[model samples]
Target chain A: MCRPLCWTYASGVLAVLAARTDDTNPLSGLVVADRPEPDVPEGWRLVRVKAAALNHHDLWSLRGVGLRSDELPRILGMDAAGVDEDGNPVVVHAVIADPDAGRGDEVNDPRRSLLSERYDGTFAEHLVVPARNLLPKPDALDDVEAACLPTAWLTAYRMLLRSGARPGDTILVQGAGGGVSTAAIVLAGAMGFRVWVATRDAERGRRAANLGADAVFDRGERLPERVDAVLDSVGAATWGHSLRAVRPGGTVVVCGATSGDPSPVELNRIFYQQIRIVGVTMGSRDELAGLLAFCAARNIRPVIDRVLPLHQAIEGFAALEAGDVFGKIVFTIP
Target chain B: MCRPLCWTYASGVLAVLAARTDDTNPLSGLVVADRPEPDVPEGWRLVRVKAAALNHHDLWSLRGVGLRSDELPRILGMDAAGVDEDGNPVVVHAVIADPDAGRGDEVNDPRRSLLSERYDGTFAEHLVVPARNLLPKPDALDDVEAACLPTAWLTAYRMLLRSGARPGDTILVQGAGGGVSTAAIVLAGAMGFRVWVATRDAERGRRAANLGADAVFDRGERLPERVDAVLDSVGAATWGHSLRAVRPGGTVVVCGATSGDPSPVELNRIFYQQIRIVGVTMGSRDELAGLLAFCAARNIRPVIDRVLPLHQAIEGFAALEAGDVFGKIVFTIP
Candidate 1:
């Protein structure tokens, strides 16, 4: 049996991880206890996890949105920075797409699954993953900081670069305080794109400006002029405004719609103005590598709102659910 | 007084070019008569029109959708193939953007306007336009055929190449027999891409197969597999199918929506799968030149469904509105 760790559910409620005979609602039945250690498969390595970061996806996992309870007692973490048995420090790329599954980009494979959804994740003291998932962590980043790079930072990096913005071009980042939005503001600024952020929260707008935004606007407010591109992760609520903020022949890259989906699409505005709306998911392993290199080369650091001991992970999940954190909440294994 | 050949719109009847005016739609009140020839501005040339093609935009012009009644006696055609005063045969590229517009590509310019919308079009025996709009026509293509290339064919070329299908990739052209769809199927085929077409009419599907479609399917029928890209011009009715038919990471390029706009978007499918949807309006002068060279080099011809004398234009518009033609309809002049 593996050494147990914490898991979260619904909102703030949390429980200790444990083996359950009834696979349904694994988190509900979780109770901390000792279990046999995981055996690493060939071409995989056993990572002695030093840190794991909590993402909104983890809470969703606990609510069993993406995972069946049968996959339960499932380890629930996507971002991990750890040391190998050989003692090399590394960061794990969360998306696990089968290389041979689909045509073209591996990230597009329908069969792909992130860690903790189909496989046990990095929340525990030790976890097993395909060796290919590992990237050497930059020495400049501590375990907690490096743990934030794989999911949110990597997604933000790809959305900015691959969505067709050039250096010196102005970009409007929609819904500013989320993980990807914050990452986009910092990265676009570093890459020489003028960054303007929109947020409903006045304080978050101020925080974005502090984080190097060229300008900050109240959510849904008209800008002085149209921009070259819009980085949109806020869905439904900001969809119309995002479309309005871009100039003709400009692009809007959407990675998520946290508010809701199925917004009214202004098709006339889309076609008549020749605006492009591109959809992006979390990025690929290659993109994660590039992101790591980019951040490391430029000494870019992820914002970490709070760090909790692994045993105190319940508090970390609570912080995320309360939406009180400015950045990521990480759990360090003692 | 200047002589102007004009169409008059009367109650519940088709607009007809008349020698004398009667009370009706004020914009169409002018009679067909001799007009003083327009003076060519510097950097512009006068073309003695040998042929002009009528499009829906022309009919819309007659309906006063884009022109004012005060702008009546307006010559109305966006496409022309003619000889300049120097007697060199040329095709006029219809999009007239500001020459000094700031740009990476001229298509990105905000001040761009189509001929006949903001400027007098090419319907008359003589028309004046900027010299840059003239693309020398190959001797092999007659004036009527050359007239068809500027709007529909150029839009198709830009949508296929610039909208991101690499040669040898597979594309699903939604709606088999419109001007743009036919152009796309033929151009994509000639450019070495595997082309599949979707149409509601079985006969049109068969015709698409004849026009070099690798395969043709019923509208919204499941393709054997997803294509690398989809060319969508039929907007509302087929937008969802277009989104579904493209493989993850593939693109859907739209030029028009003959059916209507504001189709329900499958935003969940789009973002979850990482799809791209781009909107293209028309082509640039340089793209028109490339398209001309491509056709000239490959012996590619625009498919003409019917050719009529300029006076028989009402019949052409009737056939177009009736949706009976499989390809472009051109009007010839003596």
Candidate 2:
């Protein structure tokens, strides 16, 4: 049992903890606390966190979706860019699974869990993770940019890079301004894919175009032509468009359906045209390494919406919950 | 114009033609008639009919769904096995497209059409097809068995084989009685996959088990454990079970939604667990050739529900339309 580890900083650590879980108002449980540092577990290393990105996942945890109240009074950040005790700057791969049991793919392991789900995550001044989860941070990206790569960026990597898309193929990214959508836009462009974006917000569409999108469309606008693939994160709102925009034998890769699942499954259209709908989550450590190398090689930097002091993480969560931010909201652990 | 090419026996040809199209009463248009024999076009050869399989496509043609009234009175068989001009047994490939135009996949060719779409189809006395579309029928399968391979069998092949299933992977086929479902049961067993079937009809379930299904369940019955992949064709009725039956990272492969598309696309479960929904159409000629070779080598034969004489073609179609047949229905031409 978690015995009120807050306000009694035995080993001197400050963290953004979930004091309680409130599904109706997720942020109601937000608390900044001073807690004892986590002991380095077997085969794990303690990392001094430099930056941690705030994802919708943090809010979900606060809402007790993946995090339980018994596990509450727990820390809440999943993506972190930090320096290990060895003083090497690194990015953390959040998935924790035994590689040998999963044929070298931790994502396929059924019992796998991510940080902030079953353990105290990286919101603290120092956090512990399996040593294998650490990858050298690219020099081209700072700590906050590297912080965004683990969850949202890696998910987009697995969805786009592994969707069997070649360099010259055209892919459509549905929903602009969201972390995964914008990340896909940048990654697709850098990887030589012809990228397009759709959004209700014209300002976000213009920003996506400036990020190298070939074209931008109003939400539900007609595509110039059918594309080879579509990346959808906005669920009910854009799912129909994602299904309709791909060419015959093309694919629709999904990571999150944030808007919620839409009605009328569109089975006839899927079968008649021969489309593929692939679901992706956070990628493997090997993939994360590749993403780092690719970012370093291509000089790609993740887009950051805003960064706030660790003690002021509530402002970050409030911005994310309000849905006013364009990209990732990172917390600087001070 | 079709010009009512019906009974008069003017040119000594026997065929099942769509005399008219009626949405409410499709069978009224289905007519077994005597018409002018097919003339061999350039680069095409006359294949003296031996056996032709009855499929839902013919019923659809009669219902004005792909075949229009202007295209009515057109002969309507899609899968045929017969002797070519050289007097060698051959199975006709129904799809017609330039492989070079679609990266060696005609299914990707935007304007590609299947037999009975733009040209006269296989249900006729000495139907003619492009020489390239003919693959020598295997010695192992008789005319009736070979006739079932092109449409139902080939579509099942594409769905299961291309669904990325490895030998010994557990896959659940949702329906039990349809041509594709039975074909999947046999093919998956032959390929070393652990196959299961779910059927509402107890007799069909017993038949499916006899065809080598590892296990059988009542329609929508709870599975013992989630499987690696699910094959769905009974759309609205089984779509929910399909989504629920697959493990995280498992796939839901579909070829046809015979039951109509269902509502509430289940976006939450899909994104949360990372499931794949793949849509498959008919197989390619190369894939068909491989299937034929596999069947011949494996000593596998298509299961026939019944075989009727060419003049009694209506009985075969009626059985198919009524959904009373558990396997393929073939019509033999004397």
Candidate 3:
């Protein structure tokens, strides 16, 4: 039988079946039971989740983020690809911001919150999201491929396209083997950009080349020529290198700092060379739609390192924590 | 006769002088002597300076910036408005970069260097600059008014227009009393943007309002609403407030750091809100030309706090160092 509530904890606790009333480790507690699967709430639709992918954010949530111990039994997971009750396969964009909340651009609204923060998110057997967040999954892609896109893939798409880069531009992707970096390399290569990869590990560099990077280099290795833009997520360690690798008037887009934050900003280089540093989060629903269409039209498939049954999610999380995966680790549900 | 070389040094040492033969202190070493006036080089024009502006940068040059004790006998000033050899009034653009030195956009060239750093600057009674750097001064404006541009005015123009701001946008000008902030307030006001000024002194706040700012606030005070962009030259101390004052997806354009360079960056706000931080330098020749045309067409007179004779330049520098002037302090040649 499909489990109702999914509970997660930091100390090797994995997603498990639970009763609606039972709550231990209240912060990580969640009751996703079969208490009348969510019905369409006006503009929202009930998606019977066929698959949902895991992100680092999901793990961060389990460790208690933006959720108090009193707000127990909160649904977790941000990326979902599933079938609506009408039996149509669709992908759910994870960012759950209201369109009417801001003056001009909805993305500019400060009150906006993503799924799993203020709202119950995916990972449930049945998930209901705003109709606008639902993009039809391509007939060519299976549920697993569609599930891996809403967070990591959407972030990579916006970072490359919306950050003022054009085709035939040269882009440096810092940290080669992660989900966003991998996606950026493939997307930039497809867009006809000369994509260079920087990585500390030689194995990751080789993998980046295999994933269609034009060239690969060690983390701080000098390039033959400066690039037009740099996609930097490895924060403190690669910040200086990102500044040095771009040409004058170039841009560096930063999404997350997995290594650390608080890097020494080289103000002299920034002003003297007229450099731009742009910060991006996951994209909007409109951008997510565009990304899905672009991927479907271009036959671009997300790189999936492994997929495991929902019951075996602990193994997947362990693999992720061990840093043994090159791409996304997904969880499949019935 | 104007001194070909002038010299000054710590502890009664003779320093700078300008002469046909290289002197140890070109600005301070040699006495005034009769020498042949400079002729315009090819693609250049000789400007017989009627008025020259003393910038803080000029003071820094006297203290040695990109200059050695060996190359002491050098010309100083970067801002000047004078008459050409043909007796046409002109304003000299100080940045002397080779237009054809780099690939694609000449402005993006790394090899470009400013006047005082490389070639002779505007301090002497007469100086030669590239012909393109000369903009015709309107007969309506006097030499002192025209001389206040080139560096500070051009920089402010580019920071407002070219730094990702549209008309009708709202911006926060951090540090309301400085050269760039004062210029930004006037320019942004004329261009139809709502401008807010932030400063430590309440008196400076009133002064900023008189300069055409819509509102003024105490430093680091929470704004009623987040602005579309922020103009930040005061780093470290005001960096946090600058970042906080802009809405999500807004921009922060930085040119200098009177406070300090490195600051504690709030990386969470940056990434989650998708803010853009752009570093700007002095404007290009084309930009300077646009600024000249804009001011001339609009009849905008630069704010001049005081004027001093060229011989009393030390007093001008002293006033600038005291930071009490409301606007630019210009030095006029007799």
lDDT values, one for every candidate: 0.78, 0.86, 0.75
- The native-contact fractions of the candidates, in order shown, are 0.64, 0.78, 0.67
Query: How should the candidates be ordered by DockQ, best one leading?
Result: 2, 3, 1
How much is the lDDT of residue B39 in candidate 2?
Answer: 76
- Name the TM-score of chain A in model 2: 0.96
Docking quality of model 1: it rates as: medium
Worst 10 residues of 3 chain A by lDDT: A17-26
For residue B231, model 1's alpha carbon misses the true position, in angstroms, by 0.3
lDDT of 2 by residue, B1-334 (tens): 1223347676668888888888877788877788787778899888998999988778878888778778767888889999998899999998877776665677767677778877778887778888888999999999999999999899888888766678888899988988899889999899889999988999999999999999999989999988888988789989999999988778899987777788788877776677889887777899899999999999998988999988788887777778898889989988
Among these predictions, the greatest TM-score belongs to 2
> Is candidate 1 or 3 superior in lDDT?
1
Which parts of model 3 have CA positions greater than 4 angstroms off? Answer: A1-36, A63-71, A100-104, B1-40, B59-73, B100-105
CAPRI quality level assigned to candidate 3 from its DockQ score = medium
lDDT of 1 by residue, B37-58 (tens): 6778999999888777766566
Fraction of native Cα-Cα interface contacts (under 8 Å, chains A and B) also present in model 2: 0.78
